[model samples]
Target: MSLTRRKFLSWLGAATVSTTLGQAAQAASNKHFSGYPQSHGVLFDNTRCIGCRKCEEGCNQVNELPGPDRPFNDLAVLDKPRRTTAKAYTVVNRYENDGMLQGPVFRKIQCNHCLEPACASACFVRAFTKTATGAVIYDPSVCVGCRYCMIACPFEIPAYEYDQALVPRIMKCTLCYPRIVKGLLPGCVEACPTEALTFGRRRDLLRTARERISQFPERYIDHIYGENEMGGTSWLYLSGVPYREVGMREDLGITPAPQLTAGALSAVPMVVGLWPVLLTGVYAITQRKEKIVKAEQEQAVAAAREQARAEAQAQLAQALAKAAQEKEAAIAREVKKALEEAAKVPTEQAAAAPPADTAQTPTEEES
Candidate 1:
């Protein structure tokens, strides 16, 4: 069934958060949200997992996912570490034994269905949701491909359908939301040969886990994972080794993720809504400033060129004037020397012709 765009976005935003955005915001500003009163859950015993891939087969068939490259019976695939993907909602991984001795420890990996899922906390579109049944349901029709759920999930449960170009969806275990509603167990849990995975109400499951741990203290760790982690998760795990050794995240604390992110997610609309306008204004201002600076730089350059041209002209004129004056002085000195030479020639001529023309002499005239 197709969801209307408006409803889709609304649920997308709603499902994205573990609680209402308004409430998260309000609580973050002044309070917090404790988890739901009652929800179903699953308790996984790591020591009981045999890594047979029966759960994987059940999940594949129930979900109707595409077949894997290798068949379900192939234990060779367990040689390497694996994670849940779009094709497979759940995966059972084999880890080297920490002296457990039965064989390599196997851990069934799937969505933890956190009470306050970080994925919900990050999403504003309501693509993910924590149901009353303790299942974390996803509405792909409402999802806008933000993949924020994938990022916010502390367990790293959510995966995207990169291969489906037209209609990719966020893929993860839904705790078999459809079947559980029909009073049927999740396919993987039901197919478990060793009953490693037990399904029940979260409260009851916690008690059962405690009893088991108390009874077989040597086979299990004292701590029950997901009991208080990230404000608790529907899926719990009891491991022979430390949670980390079995590929479980141990760093998450007891606080709900939504409480931590409410303050941030609350500002999402404010940021996404206002960023474009603010960024446009900033860009416009920056462009205006750059234009003004460029204009001023060009004007300064023009002024500098004009000043340099004027100075060069002045220097050229001064040099020409100095050269003209020197040329005039040299010409005058040469004319004076030529006149002296001409006077000497006349005197010599007159001295030789003095006997021939005595009457014309200057001494006769003076007498």
Candidate 2:
């Protein structure tokens, strides 16, 4: 009936098991995805672009993207660098070469639509898809607002509609897929007068890029920007200067983003699935250990208490026996002294009787 320390520890251990089990159950219920195959893609040629802001106008008109504070025709915004937003699927930013009088270089910024797109790989709810047309499309219905894709995307292309109160979705360039399906050029490619933005099969674009590089070796950089970066993006780039000068990240290695997490993601289920049984076994072992320790502690305490009690009892017994022996010795000594005193008194009385007789005879003669 006693609430011992061991019982309290066992209850605490059970609580820990319940808490960990709940967490494991929640983890098991979470969603994940492996992407679809045979997805198509596009390639962008930046060297041919002339900083005209024409692609900006084309995207806005085609997608019916919201009108900006400054009209698309206003060329002043191109003076500074700009990123893609919900209202605009793409933007044209100007990067002027230092100490060069040449016209400011224009780069069109949009989703790169990676071959192993990180956004697609990171989406647990399967909201984003890399289609066979080389376009990365998004579905809002399945989005759970986790935003893992935003962190996974190396180019930071996907922008969330945080301002919307309800039904916010990730927005980016869809590569004008409806028009492409209809066997028509994308609006941006159609609108460009100087062939700044090229729209074609990704394979053909690579051939065109190589021919240009070989034709005019001094005009273009030797490397294509997205051909192999992050395991080959569909949206490739050809810059007149270095890609870094135009704000492109060159350091992201050629490995596919999904491959980076394949090992850990594959192991998560096994680890989570086995954790409960493993933890339960460990708990049982630890509980038994605690019980053994508690038994040993209690036995030690009881032994100590019993030893102390026995020592006290032995000391008491010895004291009582010594007292009884001393009392008997004292009683014997008193009895002996009383007998000696009694014997001496009788002798004194006997010695005094002849003196009394002599005294009585002298008194009669004198009378």
Candidate 3:
């Protein structure tokens, strides 16, 4: 369409306002994230976990993480809720159901390897990656240590090595990427004595979860925790009671976090996008007002100059007229004096002629 300046400004304002509003709204929508088609996963059967802490030992051995302050066999540490840390990639927590289920629940916590991970989305330097094997990995070499990923994580994963001052790095579960590539199961999965943790492809694990729920309906809550939570994760959970009772976040909707965050960043572009029209209108108005004031000033100056020139010309004309009248009066006084002197000379000559005539008669007798 042919857009005038006013028309363009109007359209820009509407577009900017709409874009800002739309992006803010989209950040909270519910949607799922589907990762690679061939991604591998694990399903943790919380109903079967014996809270043995064997998974912790296996993770410690395989990842060679720093030694914990306490021993891994210490079951007394499960008295309180503990999360994954820089030195520990996984932790098993115990939950007392108060006779709601068959027994107390044990939950192994780690990075979920979400299909669309919030940490990956939050990192500007691309330090985090969601691998095709359903592993979310971080590269410390490229990490700027801004710690934005730490705040973005919904599962509260991605612990940072605060003591490693010279070269701090984020620590989290990699889903056993190296061993999985070598065709070996994760240490935690292999060390489970009760088969509480099941290792398989995500699709197979999800199907297996459904089968277990269908066969033993009374044994499970029928709601697979990670199957659709945050758009699916490599780590799944099946619980006897509600997932919340076992330290799982039930309020986290099925929406992938990245999609919801896209709108919050939209405000940045709105600042950039709307400035063009707003500044242009302001500048145009200021310039027009300046031009009008300048023209008025110039007109006033020209009128004053014209008035001064006319007054000077009138004064010159009056001075010339007065000088000509004074010259005419001086010439008339000289002419009257000359005429009176000529009349006096004629009368004096006629009186002198009578004496000459008497003297001439005597001379004529002698002739």
For each candidate in turn, the TM-score is 0.66, 0.69, 0.75
For model 3, residues 230-267, the per-residue Cα lDDT tens digits are 87788999988888777788898987777776766766
How many clashes in each candidate? 10, 5, 3
lDDT of 1 by residue, 213-277 (tens): 99999888899998899988898889899888888878887878777765776676665545656
Q: 197 in model 3: Cα distance from truth in Å?
A: 0.6
RMSD after CA superposition, every candidate: 11.3, 9.1, 11.3
Better of 1 and 3 by lDDT: 3
> Scored by Cα lDDT, where does model 2 land?
0.77
lDDT of 3 at 189: 95
Candidate 1 global lDDT: 0.84
Candidate 3 TM-score, true structure as reference = 0.75
- What TM-score does candidate 2 reach? 0.69
lDDT of 2 by residue, 32-117 (tens): 32223443445566666777778878888888877887987888898778888888888888888863336667788888877668
Please name the candidate that would achieve the greatest TM-score relative to the true structure: 3
Residue 276 deviation, candidate 3, in Å?
A: 4.1
RMSD of 3: 11.3
Error (Å) of candidate 2 at residue 269 is 2.3
Clashes by residue pair, model 1? 12-125, 12-126, 13-124, 13-125, 13-126, 14-126, 15-126, 16-120, 16-126, 17-120
